[model samples]
Target: MDRPKPCDLVLTLSLSRGRYGVRFAQDPAEVLAAQSLRHRAFFSRTGQSNASALDVDAFDSTARHVIIFDLASADLVACYRVQFLEGAEIAQAYSAQFYDLTALADFPGILMELGRFCLHPEHHDPDILRLAWAAMAHLVDQAGVSLLFGCSSFLGADPLRHAAAIGHLSARIAPPDRLARAKTADRVALNAFAGMGTAAEAMAGTPALLRTYLGMGAWVSDHAVVDRTMDTVHVLTGVEIAKIPPARAKALRQIVTDCLGYNNTVSAMH
Candidate 1:
């Protein structure tokens, strides 16, 4: 397979009413800024008080960072770290803690790990979310990635508290083919949340991020893993980009088009 060109590495989108821009991190300053924004939004106020401003991990050395900046305030609003599968990076995928990856033993082509996703709470505008999705789509298309995987988090460690939500995910979002079924890491099964409800009602009371993933054809693992670093429970999620819902896909494309026009460029990496 041919490698993605440098011009295909980043994307930029602009909105009509409000200003929104999505692009890849070109320097260490931008990456640090994105990490600071994540710290402020997720760690400072949330129960995960122990998290440090530097959210970098094993993936940082080889991962590419995508960031959305609010043009109006000149501030970083949202960020996600993506690592394309190759060499050692493939051996250390982030979702390893929650699922039995061996099930995907035969899956072919390149894999991308999406992790450390976060948005400044104050900038919860839906446009920002749309722009981020657009950036992701562009990246996947450019890289020719076949699978997008990540560990999505729930607020607390107690599954009982989020039983309805977990149940809804299990019912509505089916895993991709049989090859993608989520396997518990340590033999822990999600039996208690097996038959909860629809994805809509289950996540009605939860955060917007999880809901967005469900809308984009993401499926949850059968169990949650305890993440002491974030002080939360997380589930392995996988999405086949080519299979994203039609309506949502169209919307994301529109957002990307709009942003590219505003920036007076066909692509961000250019």
Candidate 2:
């Protein structure tokens, strides 16, 4: 795999009305800015004041950090941590800390795990989200990743509180049966929602980040695990990029072009 190039170039992306930019965090301070953004979004909302003021973990060392910045305000609006899974290192992957990926045991290609995804609550413009995903598509191409997987979180840890969304994913959204199981002792069974949760309700409780994953034809696990530290309920989610519909691929390619500039390789965009 090619080593990720360090970048600090300020990108300007054109929009129908305004503009935004995407940049890879090139230093610890920039990464810390991303962490602070996450800390602000996840902690304050969840009332987890006791947790550290920064959202961080060991994965930050091994992961590549991507951030979307508002060119107008020059503030980091969103962030995601992506790690390439390799060799015995798979045992230490961030997702492995919560779910069982044994089903991918036979898969023989590069896989990237994405995590620490969050957007500043005050910034809800879809352009920021588009920039983040475009950066991700670039990362996936550069690393030659065939599969992208990670944990997508909801506001709170209580499964019943997220029953509608959980049920919807279990009912109609899933990875191949072999790859979507969560192996937690406290995992709530999706079947437990029979006759209770509805798809509409599920959509109501689902977070925007997870919703994006679902739209990409990603699948979720059978259950969500309560994360006390983060004060959120999250499930394992994965998408096979090769399986994305052509139209979706085209949309991502255009976004990357707008965000990263048209000079990017056409093969990478595809």
Candidate 3:
């Protein structure tokens, strides 16, 4: 699929110093290497982890993998797997294990699942995040994806600490149509944090990640789930690209463009 056009000048300036590039894995070795980097970032392991390094589930074979390499260092810095659900591939999507498929039965257009997102710990430069989003925009444009959905996770199993943040999210952002309404499995429940409000002051201490999503017009599900494998609690979040706020969308596009130029070459040392 054709990628999105490069971002504007400001975004270019932000990522210009680094040799960064993103591409779909064309071979098994690249896929494995992407997996290895995921293992390192997600499990705190080097090279590979016997207990958790091989985190591939039923989704690996069907999903398209995007890997970012630091050309100067020749190291994989970021990666994500995207699964398109439509036509022949619809029956094999991976998120079915966590979400109820019945809720999505009436959606009229194509849907894509963004999952297994991970980045190397040392490469947490904000520019990398921008580049990843740029790549995502490119992918969405190419696939003609109308809606993007996935489970955005918090770092630990505790939802109490994040209650104020989650409550703030629930009160502000509205979920998609009924088909996309958030529902938790029986194992998890939505925790209510009393006195939470939508005021900026009330949400001042929310996690940056959730804040980012809210800024992008994303809506949270009704409840949260405990993901034993990742040892975290997560809420379902979905965004309709066309419905994204105009100003924020423009800002995202600009940021992504700036980061692309920086990612044009990879670092040899990562």
Candidate 4:
């Protein structure tokens, strides 16, 4: 299989009528900024506070870090890392460490795994999420990525609190039985969450990123693995690029187009 070429995803979106831009992390300091945000977003709720804390792991070296910056103030607001792989390289994927991906071993197409997705704890502007997806769309189109998969995390490690939201995914968007079986000993079957929570409560409790995945016709694994280290529960989520809804694809592409136009205009000025 051929490897993907270097991505040229440059998004400078006018989010919330404010300046926010997306680009690959250019240096160690920028990568550290992304790690620092992940540490805050992932640990603050657990009462952990270390100003020097960073969420670093072996995967950092292999993945391309995507960072979103508030251009107006030069603050790094959101970040996620993507690793491109062919089915032959599946074992190297970060998500492979948590879930059983044997079902996808013969996928026969380019796959992208998005991990460590987080936003600044204090920055809650919804448009940041939109821009994130738009950025992913840009890369997906450029790389000819057939599948986008990742661990879509719920904030806490306990399953009960997220039962309803988990149930909603289990009941409505579970992946085919052949995919992503539980590999972790601490996994909770989706059946445990089945019929557990109200639809309203479920939607309210579901993480925004997972909700975005569902909206784009993504599906989740049959169980969630508990990660006490991160204090979260997450299920393997996958979106077949070809299966994304037509209207949703159009909307995402429009954002990508707008950002590309902005990037080109800026390039000409330079």
- CA lDDT of each prediction against the hidden true structure: 0.66, 0.71, 0.64, 0.80
1 against 2, candidate with superior lDDT: 2
User: Model 1 off-target regions past 4 Å?
Assistant: 1-17, 46-52, 86-89, 172-188, 196-200, 264-270
TM-score for each model: 0.80, 0.83, 0.78, 0.90
When sorted by TM-score, best at the front, the candidate numbers are 4, 2, 1, 3
Among all candidates shown, the one with the greatest TM-score: 4
Candidate 2: lDDT over CA atoms? 0.71
Report the lDDT tens digits of candidate 4 across residue range 95-146: 8888888888787678899999989888888767767877898888877789
Candidate 3: count of backbone clashes, pairs at least 3 residues apart or interchain: 22
- Cα error, candidate 3, residue 64 (Å): 0.7
Off by over 4 Å in 4: 1-17, 172-178, 263-270
Name the regions of candidate 3 deviating beyond 4 angstroms. Answer: 1-17, 45-52, 87-91, 172-176, 179-188, 194-209, 256-270
Task: Give lDDT tens digits, candidate 2, residues 148-225.
Answer: 888888777787787777777775446474365566776776666655666677777788877877778887777778
Q: For residue 11, what is the lDDT in candidate 1?
A: 40
Error of 3 at 91 (Å): 6.3
